[model samples]
Target: MMASPYLQCDSEQKLQCHWGLLLPPGCVVIQTSSSLTKMGCGSSIPKNCKVGGKGRKRHSIIEEVAVFVPTIRIPVDSDVVHPLRGLVSKELVDRLSKLRAHVVSLSEEIFLLTESRLEASVEFRWKTLDDDQECCVSSAWYEVLSVVHMLAMLALFEANLMLIPKDGQVGGERKVSEDAKKDVVDSLLKASGCLDYSVHHILVQIPAQVKKSFPCYLQEGMLEAISIQALAQCVEIQLGLASECEKATLSVKRRLACELVTYFSQAHYCLSGCDTSDSYGKKLLLFLKWKCMEAKAVAYYYHGLVLDKGAEASNHISAVCCLSAAEDLVTDSKRACLSFCLASPITRVPPPWGIMKNMHKKIPDAAYRKFQMYGYLFEQDKNSAHQSLPDLPEFALSLKPEGYELPSTDSIWDNVDSQPQIQSLKEHLNDEEDEVETK
Candidate 1:
């Protein structure tokens, strides 16, 4: 065999340059896109292109050039290789764990204090007090509820973070151990319980206390704001419960879905009075109303899932309708949010008395991504089996009794005639435009 041109060359670079020059003028030398492509090209090249062999044909030079020419390859990270690479730091996890424990302890302390105070009252009578004293009592009560709310929020964040693998891998390739799954479910259930308790205290207990204390003790605006806050919290907890119960038994999942739907329905009813006209309070209420709608969309999506997984063959059509309604709700919510953001000024306003400052923080993306995921799953498999419950007795035991009781759907439409006349989005937008023009 004739000595290969590569062997005669002083270096590989020279051989490559020579081969490049030997190629036909019109032929293009395209850079390979990846390492796999390069390897494929290397393997498929003609045998005559070997280092010591002669190429009898001119086309052999082109094949030799394709094989020997170096191509830049970018390294692609694979979740299979490093599943837990991007998870939160160990120190943060430890801190969150400690904080969650402390919150639970503090909640117990506050609940006991409130219970004792309630028991001491005679016919829920309030002691005669001046305006300042009444204000002090109101402030104290608001502060306690606010603290509980914040703690529940913190616990939720911690629980979600904990569910992420320590190795940072969130991809499906990483098979979660039974112990790890159990731990996650337990943590989430605990967090949901804390949130539910706080919401109940705010919505039911606080209102009863206010009623007993004195008329006008809590301002009307303050009471309205608090009710809205509690309702919002209720929606959040239900949505979280629905998410955590996704891998639970069909019955458990269905119960969660039912609760979610009921909560969403109630939230919608509460938000009916939210005025979106001009003031800061109205703007905040408008934002909250959009949030309620978004939450309802997610609940409907879950309800659809439950129906699809059930044994009834008729449920498939119901599932499709539920999903369709969810999509419409999401679209409307987005439009409402956009309109509210555009119409409302960014200037901060003093919150109404007893309403916490934290309540004004910008609302998060109203469950749009979550709705999309559910939609995708429904599209993928309308008949996919319900998720099997993990083998965790503690998780099962931790499920709150409240979820089992379904809310009456009739109550949702109760007193609908009494609701204030709220204008449609277009009319509201027009009113805003007219206000700007008058200015």
Candidate 2:
């Protein structure tokens, strides 16, 4: 029989295999033939040489594979830019730096245009012989309004610069310094004093200078009316708290309010002399009267503000009279004048509902309801009077109705040179603009 391939023998036995290289020391091997013969190669084999022996371990291939693998981290991108990078990307910073040189150039151009317009308007008014000294005073006050409008427009233009990508933060962005605030307060007070002086000058000068020259008898009265309107407008403009003015413990607001009332009262006395025959003058007079009425209305509404400090009963009564007169005098046409006059007395002294019921004459239901609502809003106690301000159907009493078209005054004035300067002034201020920025 042929020997097995795994079998090992000595040199004398054909040297088929060496037992030392074929298996671990002490290992044993078995050989068998088809006739049931068996052979062993070694005996007393090492403990580890046996399959499933104690102290032998199995290892994982996954841990060995992970040892050589590397790890990586990823991040997300967000696109955002800082605010002060004026109209220029970082790539174009050098090119955009030129904008700083021209910044004040545009500002000065706008200021000169505004100043020219004001000078022209003032010159025009100065030449009008029909206007009295009081009219001149009113005309001069236009400077204040014009200046404020100019400042506001400038502020608007500067605000547009915020859209521009700025290279660096602009100066003057922080609150004004203490010294600056003091300077502003001093300047404003000076201006206010000038206005007061102007009022006095007109009131004293106009009656002496133009009272004799006027073709109409009501010339002095008309001047007084215009002065009142001017004063009221001034009060409205300056009544709001200014930044520096707020720092001071004292305010000019109350004095301004008193002056407004005083001027309006004088205007009422003057309007009594105006006549319908003087159409141009009468129209102006009517406008001034309307302004006075509005001022009085506002004054009356706020009259109770000092009640916490214990105002007198007579003051309350006078306040009621002012409010009632204001309501009655608020008119659109001369046709309503007689009705207004008749309604004035009853409105001044509003009686109880019982008294209104006992009246001998019949009144229109709508008119009576309207007056009742007014009384409830203005004449009644705190809560009830608050309801009187706009509760009435204003449309019913308005001269101009909804969807109504009126002829343009510009068409009539097209041939006249009077309003050209004003038109030019408006156009200059509103000229083409792209962008502006402040802090």
Candidate 3:
């Protein structure tokens, strides 16, 4: 058996070559051109028909079989094999040996553990936490393990790139090298695998910080970007070939909905910031106005909060506009579902002053429910404008549970429309009528 040139042979010779086995004799060759005449004798012939393995016939069936074989056997001399590549060369082998030594000396497991814990600390804002609070060191450890796994997968991917060949061409083989890595990523995501590595040496593992950094780094952003890229590439690959499912899944429906809600809230928050009469609020308000559109609920909610907080507070027009936009977006089933799922900073309702001013006539019911949702805010501590609204025209007092009770003279519900009634002296009339009926 011939030894590979890339491999060390059993013999004393450090270098070996396997050209004979690599491209054996009697191997047929065939070629086709863009514009061609009747190519001669496009048919099969005996193996021994020609001196150079290819028959005298211009085209042969055996040659076609050799060309069309599904198997790809990349030769050691291929570009992908090694940098200088006659085989795995002395330089590569030596380099690989050194790398192994270094890896062994440093210990990837320990390095990963230490690095991940430090990162997690930074991510979780552990340094800011009270020392008495027990830090979630486990998440930090897991993050470390996740990073290690990512590294291992990448290393294996590079290894496979050198080992696997898809077809005869060096290009084809190189293309498939990435497939292994993609598969590994896909597998990890599908499984939602957890890691056990740690970076406990660094900052505290605060929950909120940990949650934010974990996904953006570990897998979420990459997955999202890749998914979008795949959708685009697939469309370009086969023009007019999109299936119904693909079209729908890759559509902008969900994104549009999200953006619509996002902008309205930004507008509201921006306006509220302006009302604060402070540099911070003004700067934030102006920034938001420039950066965001008036289409998101979050913007509206935040603006309302800031406005209500500010000294020169009421921008009723802008506030109402923002709230209106937010309502429009969230009225839909999809947006409504998202509104429920995703918690926002400004979604908290403020205490009612007189009436819920931003409550739309069209969506009175939802507005009322929203008002009721934040009803507790009034109970916190209130006496005048900040107090719970009196049962006004919009919110009828008659419908309330306490409606049966008589109102005080100062109350709006007090009886000011009618005069006092007088009792009748009808005892003689009642007796005369009773006597006539009896007779």
lDDT of each: 0.34, 0.28, 0.26
- Expressed as tens digits, the lDDT of each residue in 1-439 for candidate 3 is 2221111223322111211111111001111111001121111223333312123333222111100011111001101112212222333324333322322222111111222222222111111010111122334333233323332222222222223343434223123223443442232222122111112211223354544543222233222222222222212112112211266322232233233334323333324322334332333333233222322332344343333333431233333333445455334423333332232211211121111123233233433544454445545534435332211111111110101111112111122321122224574456456557755
C-alpha TM-scores of all predictions? 0.31, 0.26, 0.19
Give the true-structure RMSD of model 1: 32.0
Worst 10 residues of 2 by lDDT: 64-73
Write candidate 2's Cα lDDT for 1-439 as tens digits. Answer: 2222122222323221211111111111111111111112122112233212244343321111000001101111111111112222332222112221111111100011112222222210111112222212222123222222222222212221221123322221223234432333232222333223333432243334433433332244543444344344334334323212555222233344445556556656766776535434544444455445544433433332222123644434433444444344333212232233233121111111111121112222323443443444344455443333321111111111112111112221123432223225544344322112211
- Candidate 1: lDDT of 33? 18
Q: Could you say which candidate leads in TM-score?
A: 1
The parts of candidate 1 lying over 4 Å away from their true place are 1-218, 221-246, 250-254, 264-278, 310-313, 343-439
The 10 consecutive residues of candidate 3 with the worst lDDT sum are: 66-75
What is the C-alpha local distance difference test score of candidate 3? 0.26
Candidate 1 lDDT tens digits, 1-439: 2221112223444323322221112100111112112222233333443311233332222111100001111111111101111222233223323322332222111111212332222111111111111122332233333333333333333333333334533231223344544443443343344335444444454455554443331233333343333333433444344344446564554454444444434434543554324343455455556655655565565566666675653455456556666667666776755654554343211111111111222112223433444555546666755321111111121234122111112221233442334457886677568657755
Models ranked on lDDT: 1, 2, 3
